[model samples]
Target: MSTTLANQQRSKIISLLSPAYLWLTVAIFLPLSAMLYFSFLSDVPFGQTEWHLTTENYQAFFQTTTYAKLLWKSIKLGLIVTGFAVLVGFPCAYVLAKVIQGRAREALFLLVILPFWSNSLVRIFSWAIVLRGNGVLEIGLNAILPFEVDVNLMFSTPAIVIGLVHSYLPYVILTSYLALQAIDDNLIDAARSMGAGKHTILWRIILPLSLPGLLAGAVLIFVPVVGSFMEPRILGGRVGTYFGTVIEDQFVAVFNWPLGAALSFILLAVVLVILALSSPILRRAQT
Candidate 1:
């Protein structure tokens, strides 16, 4: 009787979870497995083409310094973009969560995330027009100032960073707003009644509870930015050749599928390591 009951419970659990597990297998695990399998091959598997297992694809990354340098450049870009997003989005989130209320907060929230509804490619191209020499930004600055200004941000690293910040800023704002809003008003009031100053309250009570969300948003921003190529290509031009662009070249222009797969696997490993390192702190904060 006990065994039968246990078996029935197991079957019920599997029935509930089967659909999601099946979707994960079909959508994610299979593709990743295929990529890993292909990464070990010497050549692409096509009709009449000879292919064999080899580790040269990964070795290319180690033998040459270029890949490492480009990867470092990408990581640096992620950090810079994440920093800018946090700095610019935090105050907006605070206002939305604490300062504003009622219908005004809802409207402001909608306005803050309005850019997310637009096509990302369109937005990047629009920035290109605005950042070009003698463009809107240049014209505006020159019009206001006595001295003529040349704003040639186009085809530069800063341009890429700006586009990325514009694209991902809302993630931080949304995450931080959720975190800040979850705090109890009475806790803040008690802090105030206990003679805690504004800075002290913010530093001690607010920042601690909200840190988890900030980290979550930062992780979200950093991970995709590390893998980004399109925005950098469109905005950074000559300076856009980072790790992701190199991987893109391997798959698109170079047609080295195995090498690209290997590079992608390496990047996945790096991202996993970053998340693993941060998970402890995030877990502690949540607790």
Candidate 2:
């Protein structure tokens, strides 16, 4: 009877998890597997297209320095955006989670997440309108200042960074807010009672305790930013060519699916290696 109950509980657990497992296999694993296979082929195995297994796609990456430089550029862009998001978001999160009271907190929290309410394309274009030469930002600034200053940031790296930071800043805020909220107030009070300074409390207590969430937010921002093409293409214009844009061109413009797949896999490998290397540090921070 005991054995039968254990078996029934195990079956129930499996049943509950089966749908999630199925979805992962169908939505994630299947596509990844297909892409991996495609990466090894000389051409896509569609219609009358002749194709065979080849390593040239992967070889092309190592053969050319252009892809490496673009990948590094994308990585740099990801780091810059993540850094700005953390620097800006953490303070806003701290104010919201620790300082604010009553309805003010709720209002500010709503504002923090306001970016999510609008379409990303709309937001990019809106920034473009403000940042373009002689546009809203330039006009407004020139009006305020004694001298005229050129303030065109559109179609530049700065524009890409600004747009990306605006888009992903909320992730850091939301995650850090949750982490900060979880810390007991008594712990902070106790530190104060022990004669800890404000900077000391923040550095030793609040920051350390909330680091996992910060790291989580950083990873969330970094990963998608690295692979992003649309924002760069629209915001950076002629200067927007990154690893992601290159891969996109291969697939969309050049119609080279196999090469695109190879580039995609290389990017995936790099991201995974980075995560694996940093995960130990993140885990250590939690302790």
- Please name the candidate that would achieve the greatest TM-score relative to the true structure: 2
Best by lDDT: 2
* Per-residue error (Å), model 2, residue 176: 0.8
The TM-score obtained by model 1 is 0.91
- Stretches off by above 4 angstroms in model 1 are 1-17, 281-287
lDDT of 1 by residue, 64-137 (tens): 89999999999999999999999999888988998999999989989889889999999999999899998889
- The TM-score values for the models, in the order shown, are 0.91, 0.95
Model 2 segments beyond 4 Å from truth? none
Give the alpha-carbon lDDT of every model: 0.93, 0.95
Candidate 1 lowest-lDDT run of ten: 278-287
Q: Candidate 2 residues 196-260, lDDT tens each?
A: 99999999999999998898899999999999998999999889999999999999998999999
